[model samples]
Target: MRREFKLPDVGEGLTEAEIVRWLVKPGDQVKVKQNVVEIETAKSIVELPIPWDGVVAALMADEGQTVDVGLPIIAVDTAEPGVPAGGAAGTAVGTAAGAAPGEAIKALADDMVPRPPAEGAVEPGAHGSPAPKEERQAVLVGYGVKTGATKRRPRKAPAPPAAAPAAPAIPAAPVANPSRVEVTAHPVPARVAVLAKPPVRKLAKDLGVDLAAVTGTGPEGSITREDVRAAAEIVAQPEPRPARVAAPAGAEERVPVKGVRRMTAQAMVGSAFTAPHVTEFLQVDVTETMNAVARLRAMPDFADVKVSPLLLVARAVVTAARRHPMINSSWDEEAQEIVVKHYVNLGIAAATPRGLVVPNVKNAHELSLPELARSLGELAETARAGRTQPAEMAGGTITITNVGVFGVDAGTPILNPGEAAILAFGQVRDMPWVVGGELAVRKVTTLALSFDHRIVDGELGSLFLRDVGAMLEDPLRMLAWS
Candidate 1:
């Protein structure tokens, strides 16, 4: 028997996904719950696992192809090794021996054709007693199965392939360039295959690095991300050029908008226009907070985790939000009401290769300082690797964008959709200030708070900003407020 596997809705009400890569190919045997393909949805990259044990008969879709939620993407043959597809009773050899040429070929093809599994029998070993059809299947990370009809965007026709160049004749003498000599003296090296993992290959493709030209340093001569980055750096160097140069045709490259970048663009545009933004700025002397971070880093509790100024800033935000509940809230236009949240899902904006993603720590106000630091570190690492789940980015009550990491001072930030406020932390610098009528050098930083004017008035916004600044100015204030 042959079974066709349709793409399930991998949560977040997504209609379609792009096939990033296929882990298995035709003729490869795959077991139940084994990941067979990696797909990129609007939110993040997800791996889809096969639900049955079978040999891969065919891949219905190509890598990089956009497939709808209910479309079949792969076919698997579930019959025993010696038995013909469809069953022994409808064996292709038996039917061919007695039927006409056309009829025999049609019979064999029919036997090999894939059929969708019965309703409620999507999982392996579930045919005996089918589960409820509406029940969710845990096939993809952070998502469940949702069956629905979706329209697939028409794919553009591929451009015609360019003609291959003629092979170069081998040189009889040694070449001047050592790299060219190896190519001319020996042809075997040229034919050597480029070895790299799927993720490494994806990195090389994104960086526009030619893997054939890169020398791999990994075990067994496989390329690594560091190698790709090094090659990209070398390729990025500028060469000497004439002062005046003629413009060339088609100098620009067009990148298709999709995935995380597409979703981020849409969300940002909606937030900027829908929310009436009011920004407030404050300068604070954070010398005490800086010293506290250093002391925390040396303490046993924080020895294993990273301690930075951002940690204290995050703590201050959470503490201030508690003091002023209205600051951590949202505007409900439909209900014409203000919704103030009791718990804080503190969002930390992180810039990743894909784009800007804010994965917050759930219930941050309830966590200890050390726990918050650990969560923040893990969140950063996960975002950098492009593994943050959609759930982690949802339900954020307030956000903090640390522009300081980029060596930026400060700027008015747009509020995250559904959230009432966002805080921007700037780079800290040493500045001369007057304390007790005496001028002294102090560690100073700027904070920009942008809030929904409709939800928080000017006075309330100012008070919230003042409280956060005070907490940072004196770390002891956080304890008193708590």
Candidate 2:
């Protein structure tokens, strides 16, 4: 029986997902709960499993195609024998020419079964018939086929000529057998089997590199995407550009904004216009905070955890929020009230390949220093890997963006859609400063706090920034304030 698998909502109530790659192809056998395709939803990249075991009959959607939820993406033949396939329940029903539309699909399943070649049968060729490509089984959950030496049914070699008692001087007329004639006239080229992922194979094809000629550097001698690209660089010549060429008038490239970029743009625009933003800037000597980060790194408890200046900043924000609860709040326009959250869900803005995503730690104010460090590390890693679940991005009371990573000083960061404020951490640099009424060099960094004026007034915003700045200026003050 042929079964069609529709795209399921992986989570987050996603309405659609882009087909990143198809791990199974037509004629390939697949099992129940096998990851047959990888899809990119609005939240993350997910591998979708096939529910029924069968041979893949067709792929309804191509890679990079956006498919809606409940739409069929792959068709699998599940019937072993006897039972008939029908059109209902996602099964494909087919019929011969001049047959009814509801006719049972029996021919498809039968054709899928392999058969032996008859005696004196003509081998598949360009002039005779198209050659049958070898089909290999694939793994349960990955971009590779089943790993092992491929075994193919051997073809019977031509029989040796028998010695006759009487020898004839003239040569006998050719038997004119189609297989022998075609094989002798146009010899078939030997096929080289190479182990490579589908994406790597596509890359090799695009680069015009023969996978068989390129040595693989991956596990089990498998070819990787980098191997294909490197081989392409060595073999493919760069196309020379035409001097002084002009583009056609009114020519422009158009890109469809649909995924994370689209979501980010929408949120930024909404927050920028909807909220009356008040930005407060402060320059603080973070020399003490940097030293504290170094100390934390040396601590036995933080031996396995990654401690950074951001961790100190996050800890400071959480500590300061406890002092000024209004800073950790949202403007409820519908309710005509400011909702101040008692527990801080501190959002750390992370820039990923998809776009800007803020996955927060739940009840950050309650977590210990080490626990907070671990949460921050896990959140960043998950966001970078494009695996941050939708739930991790919700219920953020306040956010902090570390623009310092890009050597940026500071900027007025827009509030995350529902949050009341966002803090931008600038690059810490050695700058001349007055210490004890004398000139001295210190690690100084600028902080920009942008908050929703409707929720947090200037007095509240400044005090919050001052408190955060003070924590960074004197790392010991966090313990004192806490």
Tens digit of lDDT per residue, candidate 2, span 4-102?
A: 566666654455688888898878999888989988777667787888888987777768877645545676788655345443333333332113211
lDDT for model 1, please. 0.80
Best by lDDT: 1
Q: TM-score per candidate, in order?
A: 0.67, 0.64
**Where does model 1 exceed 4 Å of error?**
79-250
Each candidate's lDDT (Cα)? 0.80, 0.77
Locate the minimum summed-lDDT window of 10 residues in model 2: 96-105
> In candidate 1, where is summed lDDT lowest over 10 consecutive residues?
129-138
RMSD of 2: 21.2
lDDT of 1 by residue, 1-482 (tens): 66667677775677668889999988999999999999988888888889889998767677877764655577678765544545764354444434542343334432332222333332233223322233122355323243323334444545665975756767788678755544334333323355564457777997899998999896546677889989988898656445866458788666878888888898998899999999999999999999998899899999889999999999999999999999999999999999999999999999887788988999999999999999999999999998888889989999999998888889999988999999999999999988889999999999999999999999999999999999999999999998
